[model samples]
Target: MAVYKVYAPPAPPTGGAASPEHFVFVRESFSWAAFLIPLPWMLYRRLWIVLAFYCLAAVAMALLAGSELAPVSMALGVLTPFVLGFEGNALRGWSLDRRGYTLEGVAEGRRRDDAEIRFFTRWVGGHAAAPQQPTPGPAARTLPITTLRETPTGIVGLFPTAGTQT
Candidate 1:
């Protein structure tokens, strides 16, 4: 996997005090679904517990007007914000913004203490298009490996030069 270290401005210090700190940001990869799916399932699981209220509403609506409207209203009530929240989480690739390092990427699960987030991203043309550069820090270093693989739970590294043909 390729890791680039880029500088970022830190957030304002807490307690209305200023402190000197340097931070770096890195990018992890994700597919489009990284922000979709999972919403309906999570919502559906929670919705089951409220089935009683839905039953009552259905009967009430039937007596006042018609049963059809109850299902529609109930569906909307359960789905609207749930979908919104899920989409928000998916699109917002998980990140760790801290004293001096930031990692942004999509991962199936997170390790404790936000130590690492596993995610997958692909490089075009099956390889980097141009020569890469070493990031400046305490020392400059080159990435000996290139491709990072994604599993349902996290990332697994494969040989940098060993990936499917683009």
Candidate 2:
């Protein structure tokens, strides 16, 4: 199953048709296209900062490799694109974050469309976590009270226990 990362676009103005259902799912797996065409992929995604860093790194590598470590530089040149492929999603996510996309959740499926469908099915069909319901009785009326007591094991507290659970 391919992992998918869900994103919610920035909320619209207070009066607009804003909704939780308007979510987008992008595959969180490595991109073979990005690996094969790093520059073009970066351009397509508008990953300016990442592209800048890549260019700078390439230039530095080229300058440093002049004649001393051609093989090392050659290897790095080949490896960089692969690294970009593996981290393409992260780069895209970072760009999305910068552009006001919030990470909502993650899911897995057979493909991007399938993953999106699964996420939406869960999100919109009541399969996701339900809102907390108010408990019955006076639990809501009274403020919770807690006390700490020293035990043979250690300090115990969140609830003032009359005794140990055992």
Candidate 3:
């Protein structure tokens, strides 16, 4: 099952809540597209800051590859895609946060649409319920308290006695 982080856009300055249609569900999992083609994926997601950092890292790696640190640079180049695949969703979430989106809740399902359906069904149901006052109840009774030993009587694990060597 895939887990998704739900984000709702910021309310308008006129004081109305944002529409439900604008909510974004970001899948919390590795992205194969991000691993294979990170730049285009970031571009599609509008992750400008992450893209900028990725570009800078690419440039730095290229420069290092031409210098004495070629092996290290090559290793980093290979590792970058895996890191992008792992962190792509998280980066997207961070971008949404920066753009004034509030984290609504988490949802889980086999797919994005399924996750959205599950989340919205619960969300709407919760909001539709009316608040009720708590009914008065009988006074609670307190259980009798017991004291515990301040010190151990013996070794508590595999050893049977306190001073016995294992």
Best by lDDT: 3
Estimate, for each residue in 34-118, the C-alpha lDDT of model 2 and write its tens digit. 8998889889878999999999989988986897888888899989988988898888888889988888778789877787766
Q: Rate the local accuracy (lDDT) of all candidates.
A: 0.38, 0.77, 0.86
- Summarize candidate 1's per-residue lDDT along 1-166 as a digit string, tens digits: 4333233344455643222232223333332232344345335434332334445654665564445466766666566445435443322322223233233222233331132222222222222133357669967677565344443333344543344334
Candidate with more favorable, higher TM-score: 1 or 2: 2
**Residue lDDT tens for model 3, 9-105:** 8988998778889999999999888999998999999999999999999999999999999999999999999999999899999999999999988
Candidate order, lDDT descending: 3, 2, 1
Flag clash pairs in model 2: none
Candidate 3: lDDT over CA atoms? 0.86
- Tell me the spans in candidate 1 whose CA falls farther than 4 Å from its real position: 1-69, 91-110, 117-166
- Residue-level lDDT for 149 in candidate 1: 45
Report how far off residue 155 is in candidate 3 (Å).
21
TM-score of 3: 0.75
Ranking by TM-score: 3, 2, 1
Q: Listing every candidate in turn, what is its Cα RMSD in Å to the true structure after a full C-alpha superposition? A: 18.3, 7.6, 7.1
The numbered model that scores best in TM-score is: 3
